[model samples]
Target chain A: MVKLRARCLLLGDAAVGKSALCHMFHSDGTLFQKNYSMTTGVGLLMKCVNVPETNDSVELYIIDSAGKETLVEACEKMWGQPSLLCLVFDLTSEQSFASCSHWMERVHAHCEGLHVPGVLVGNKSDLSARREVQGSVAQEWAESQGLEYHETSAKEMENCDAPLLGLARAFHSLYQERRETIQNLSPG
Target chain B: MIDSSLTSLGAKVVVATSSDENHPPENIIDGNTTTFWMSTGMFPQEFIICFAEPTMISAVTVDSFNVKHLKIEKNTSQNASNFAFVGEKELEHTDGHIQTNAVSLNGSSATHLRFIITSGYDHFVSVHRVSVQN
Candidate 1:
C-alpha cells in the first residue's frame, strides 16, 4: 500500500465552525466541543484516510487557521505550501459566504499562482432555519473558482468526513498522475 | 549610551523549547526579519537570549507572526537561571504582514532576557527578529 502525506489548510471567517469540523473529522465523530475559544493562530490536526477501492492512504495534516482578519497575516506565515484547501463558511451567515472570495484570493496569492486543489464547504447545515446562503448560489460560485462544493453540519456530525476524504483522494490522484508522467519519460 | 542591535553586541539564544533546522532559534536575534525562528506546534514555547554583559535595555522590538500572549523575563546572573518578571504584552493581530511590536523595558539592566510565548493565534509561531535599544 502506498502512503502519502498532504498538508490541508482549513480556512474561513471566525466562529464559522472550522475547528468543530476539524475536530469531528479527526476524532471520527466521537468528540465534539460545544464551547470553543477563538483560534488565535493555526491549529494542526492529522488524520489518515484510506482511498476507497485502492491500496493507498493519505495522511492529511489539517491546518485549522484563525479566520479573524487581524490574525490572517500571522496565520499565512505558517501555511507553508498547502497541498489542499478546505474553504469553509457558515450557511446561516451571508457575510461569511461573501468573505469566501477574499479568502480564496489570499490562498491563491500565498500559493504563488499554483493550482491548489480545494473544496468549498458550507457548514452549519443544521441551521437551515437561519440559512441565508442558498446551495445553488454557493455551488455556482464554487464552480467559478474551480472547487467542489459540500455542505456539512459539524455540530450535528453529519457529512463531516466527506470534504477531507475528497481532499485525500484528490491528492492521491495528483500523485498518480505525476508518477505516470515520470514513467512515460523512461527510455525503455 | 548608543542604541544598538543586541545581536551585534553578542547576544545569543542560549535556550529554546523547540528548534527547527530551517528556522533556528538563532534567527530571533539575527537582525533579519526575513529569516525567522519557528516553533514546533506546541504551547508555552520560550527562548532565552543572553547578552555578553549586563546592559541597560530601554525598549525591545519584536517582529513576529501569529504570537498572542508574550511574557518577558530577565536576570543579571552569569548563569541561565533565576529570572525576574520584566513585562508582558498581548500582540495585536495583523493581516498579510509580520507583527512589529515594540515593548518598553523601562530601562531594566539584565544579562539574560527570556521571551516566553505563552500563547499564539496559531499552532506554530514564528519570531522573525528581536531588536533591543539601550
Candidate 2:
C-alpha cells in the first residue's frame, strides 16, 4: 500500500464555517456551538484518507488558520507548506466572497511560485435564496485566477469531498508525469 | 472612589472582547479598590480573564444576564490562567429573564478575582455589592 503525505490549508473570513467544514469532513457529524476563538492562531489536525481508486492512503496535515488580525503570526506559518490550499467563502455573505480576492492575494504572496493546488469553495450553498455570490460568479473568478472552484454546503454535505478528491487526482497525475520524465532522461 | 460598604482590596481584572480592528470600545473593565466592573458585548466564549493572587480562589458575580457557565482558574505563581470549569444554578428565572448563581470566595478574602467572560449573552456585570467576609 502506497502511503503518501499531503497537507491542506483552510482559509477564509471568520465564522465562514471553516472549522465546521473541517469537522464535517474529519468527524462526519455536526458539532454543537462549542468554544470558538476567532481562530486566534492556526488550528491543526491530521487525517488519513483512503483513495478508493488506487486503494492507497494519504495522510493529510490540515491547517485551519486564524482569520482574525491578532493571529497574523499563526497564518504566516502556513506559507511554506506545499500542500493544497482551499479558500472558503460564505455564499450568503457578499462581503466574504468579495474578501476572497484578498485571501488569494495573501496566499500568492506567501507561496510565491510554488505549485500549490487551490480550490475556491463557496459554502452555505443550501441557503440559495440568501446567496450573496452566485455559483457562476465564483467559478468565473476561480477560472480567471487559474484555480478550480466548487460550491459546497457543509451543512448538507453537498459536493463537500469532490474538491479534495479532485486535487488528489491531479497531484497524483503530476507526480506520475514527473517520474516518467526523469526515467526517460536516465543514462542507465 | 471606593465603596467600603461591600468589600475592600486591590487587584487587576482582565476582560476579553471580539471587536474588529476598526471597532472600538469592545469591552470595558474599570477596577476599583475592592471590585472590578465590566461591560461586554461579545459572545460568551470569546471572553477571558486572569487573576493576580497566588494560591487564591476567585469568584465571579455575574449579573444582568444568563450564563451557561463561567470558567475559573487559580495560580500558584503569576502565569496565564488555565481553563477551569464551573457550573451555574438558576438564581432567578422569571418572565423570560434569567440570572446566575452567586459565586462565593470561601470566607477567605483576597485582593484579586478576575472576571473573565468565557461564554454567553451580552450584558454588564455591575457588581452591586461585594464583601470579603473572610
Candidate 3:
C-alpha cells in the first residue's frame, strides 16, 4: 500500500462557493456553514481518499484561497507549489465563470510551464433557475483546457467528493507512472 | 532616532511555539524579507524576542505572509515569563508579495517583545522580518 501526499490548490472568484465546497469535502457532508465571511487569505484543509480496489491512499492538502482580486498576490506567495488544481466557479454567475480563464492563467504562470492535474468545478448547482453558465459550455471549456468538469452543490452536499476523489486517483496514477519509469531505468 | 532590525542590535529569539528546520524562528529578526520563519500550523502560535537591554520602541514593522491577527506583548524582566499586553492589529491580506505593516507601539520601553500570531489567513504563516523604529 502506498500513501501519497499532494498539495491541491482551490481557486475561484469571490462568492463562488469555493469555501463551501472545501468545507463540504473535508467534513464528509457532515458540516456546511450557511454564512461565510469572505476568505481573507488561504484556508488549509486536509482529507485522505482511498483508491477503489487498491490499498493505496492519497492525502490531499487542500489550499482554499481567497478569490478577491485584492488578496490574490498575498495568497500566491503562500501557494508555494501545488500538485493539483480545483478551479471552481458559480453556475449562477456568468462573471464568475468568465474569471476562470484568469485563474487558469495565474495557475499556469505559478507552475512555470509544468502540467498540473486539475478539474473544473461548476458549483452552486442547486441554484439551477439562476444559472447563467450552461453545463455544456463549461464541459467544453474544461476539455479544451485538458481538465475534467464536475457539477456540485456544496449547500446541498451533492457530488462534493467526486472532484477530490478524482484528483487523488490522478495523483496516484502519476506516481505509479513515475515509479514504472524509474524501475525501467534499473538494470536487471 | 535610528531605525534598525532588532537582530542587528542583539535581539534573540527566546521561545517559539513551533519551528521548522528550513524556516527557523531566527528568521523573524534576521533583517531580510526574503528569508522567513514559517509556522508549522495551528492558531495562537507565538514567539518571544529578548533585547540586549531595555529600549524605547516607537513602532514595529512586520514583513509577513498569511497572518490575519497579531497580538504583541512586552516585559522588562530578565526571564522569559511575565508578559503584559502591548498592542494588537488585524493584518490586511495581500497577494504574491509580503504584507509589510508598521504597527505603532506608543514608544513603550521593553527588554522583551512577544509576538503572538493569534490567527492567520492560512494554516501556515510566515514572518519575513521584524524591525523596530526608535
What's the lDDT for all of these models? 0.83, 0.54, 0.83
In angstroms, the error of model 1 at A22 is 1.0
Q: Give each prediction's DockQ, rounded to 2 decimals.
A: 0.02, 0.01, 0.02
Decoy 2 TM-score against native = 0.53
Docking quality tier of candidate 1?
A: incorrect
Writing each residue's lDDT as its tens digit, candidate 3 over A20-132 gives 98889878987888997899999999888897778877778899999999999999998876778999999999999999999999998767455678899999999989999
- TM-scores for every candidate against the unseen true structure: 0.58, 0.53, 0.58
Task: Please write out the lDDT profile of model 3 over residues B14-72, one tens digit for every residue.
Answer: 99876655567898888767677766544578999999999899988888877899999
Worst 10 residues of 1 chain A by lDDT: A179-188
The residue-level lDDT of candidate 1 at A119 comes to 88
lDDT of 3 at A185: 30
TM-score of the second chain in candidate 1 = 0.95
- Judged by DockQ cut-offs, the docking class of candidate 3 is incorrect
RMSD of each: 12.5, 21.5, 12.3
